[model samples]
Target: MSLGTVSQAGLLLALVAAATLSGCGQQTLDNSQDVAAALATGGGSSSPQATERELPTFDCNALGERASSIEMLICQEPELAKLDQQLAEVYAKAGDKAVNEQPPLLKAEQRGWIKGRNECWKSEDKLQCTRDSYQRRIVELQARYHLVASTGPVFFACDGNPANELVTTFFETEPATMIAERGDRSILMFSVPSGSGAKYQGGDYSFWEHQGEARVTWGYGAEEMLCKPTTQDDK
Candidate 1:
C-alpha cells in the first residue's frame, strides 16, 4: 500500500478523506490478518477475568414495555442527560469488545437480530417503508465494516490486541425483545420498543459521520428512534 503505486485519483480521495479523519487512530487496521491475533476469538474458552457480556435472550413484549418507560424518561431534558452518561459508558466498552469477538459466529447472531426487527416492522402498518430503508443501511454497514450476522440472541466480542485488551469500557444489558445490533466509526446507537414485540416502526441501526445525533425508530404515532444529542447543555 505504498503511495507511489497508487493512481492519482485514489491518492486524492484518500487525502481528502484524511482531513475528516481527525479522530482516527494513529495507525489504521487495513487487514484482519494483521489484526487477527488481536481480533481472534478465544474459541469459547472462558476467561474468569472476562465478565462483561450481551444478553443471551430477549422477549419483544417485555422489551417493548420497557421502551415505553425509557421513551418517556428520555423525553425530558434531565432523562436525556442521564441516558447520555449511561450510554456513553456502555458504548465505550462495547466498541472495543467488538474487535476481538468471535468473528464468524457473532455475525450470525447479528443477522438474526436484524431479520427479526425487519419482520416486526413489515407486519406493523405504522412504519410503512421505514423498515426496508433501515435494512438497506444495515447491509451497507455489514459489508463496509466487515461485520458478520448471527441468529437471535447473538453474542458480540471485540477483535483487538491482547496486550491492550479492552480495559476501560462499560457494559450494560440492553433489555429489548426488539433488539437492533448496530454501530460504526461515526455514530453508535440501537433500539427496541413495546407492545408488538419485535414488530414496530422506525427502529433501525444507524451510523453517520459528521451528522447530527440520529435515531432509527419504528411503530405508529411518532413511533421512531429519538437520538437527540446534548445540544445546549441546559444553558
Candidate 2:
C-alpha cells in the first residue's frame, strides 16, 4: 500500500481515470480457474478480514418490484450478496481516504464503475462476470487507498501497447502471493527471487525482471515483451 514518491498531479489524474474508466479492452475470463488460482496465490485465501463489518446492503427497492435478472440475482444470490456487502464496506473506507478534492472524482468514477458492472448482464456468464468486476474493483480500490498493508505494486510499461501494461499489487492475505492486473483481467502470480531481478507467474501471463527492463507475457500463446519502468504507483 505504499504510495511511494508518486507525483501529486499524476496521482490525482490516475485516480480519476481509474475511477471513471470501464473495461474497453477484451475481457476473456470464461474459466473460473483464473480467479480461483489468482486468489489462492495472491498473498491470501480470500478478502482481507473485516471484523464486525457492517456489510453494505443494496436497495433492491430502487429497482422496484420488477427487476432485471441481474438485479434479482444480486439481491437473491448468496455469493453476489456477500460480494456486494464486501464492496460496500471497502468502498466506504476508500471514500474516507479519498478526501482533499478527491471525493467528487471518486464518486463520479464509482458511478461509471456501476455502469460497467451492469454491463455484465450482457455476458454469457453473468454471475461470474459480475463477481469478477466487483472483486477486481474492490482489490484495486483497497490497494490504491492503502486499506491493507502489503509489498511492491511495481508498474511496468510494455513495449508496444499504450493501454496494455502490468501492475504487481500485493495483498496482506495468506499464502503470500501477488496479483498482477493486466488488461481487463487480473491474475495471481507467485514471486520468484532470481539473481538480481524478480519473476512472477500465473496461469495465462508472467512477469520477470531485476533492475533494467522486464519481460512480460500476456498469455500462453503470447510472446514475451520487454517493458520499461513506468512508475512505482499503481495508478
- Using lDDT as the measure, the top candidate is 2
Each candidate's TM vs. the true structure?
Answer: 0.19, 0.48
**Top-TM-score candidate index:** 2
Q: 67 in model 1: Cα distance from truth in Å?
A: 30
List of clashing residue pairs for candidate 2: 43-174, 43-177, 44-174, 197-210
**CA lDDT, every model vs. true structure:** 0.35, 0.70
Q: Tens-digit lDDT track for model 2 on 88-186?
A: 888899889888653367788788988888888899999899887887777667766668888776677778554567776776632235677777887
Task: Output the TM-score of candidate 2.
Answer: 0.48
Model 1, runs deviating above 4 Å:
1-77, 100-198, 202-235
Q: Using alpha carbons, what is the TM-score of model 1?
A: 0.19
Candidate 2: segments with Cα more than 4 A from true spot:
1-56, 101-103, 153-169, 173-213, 216-235
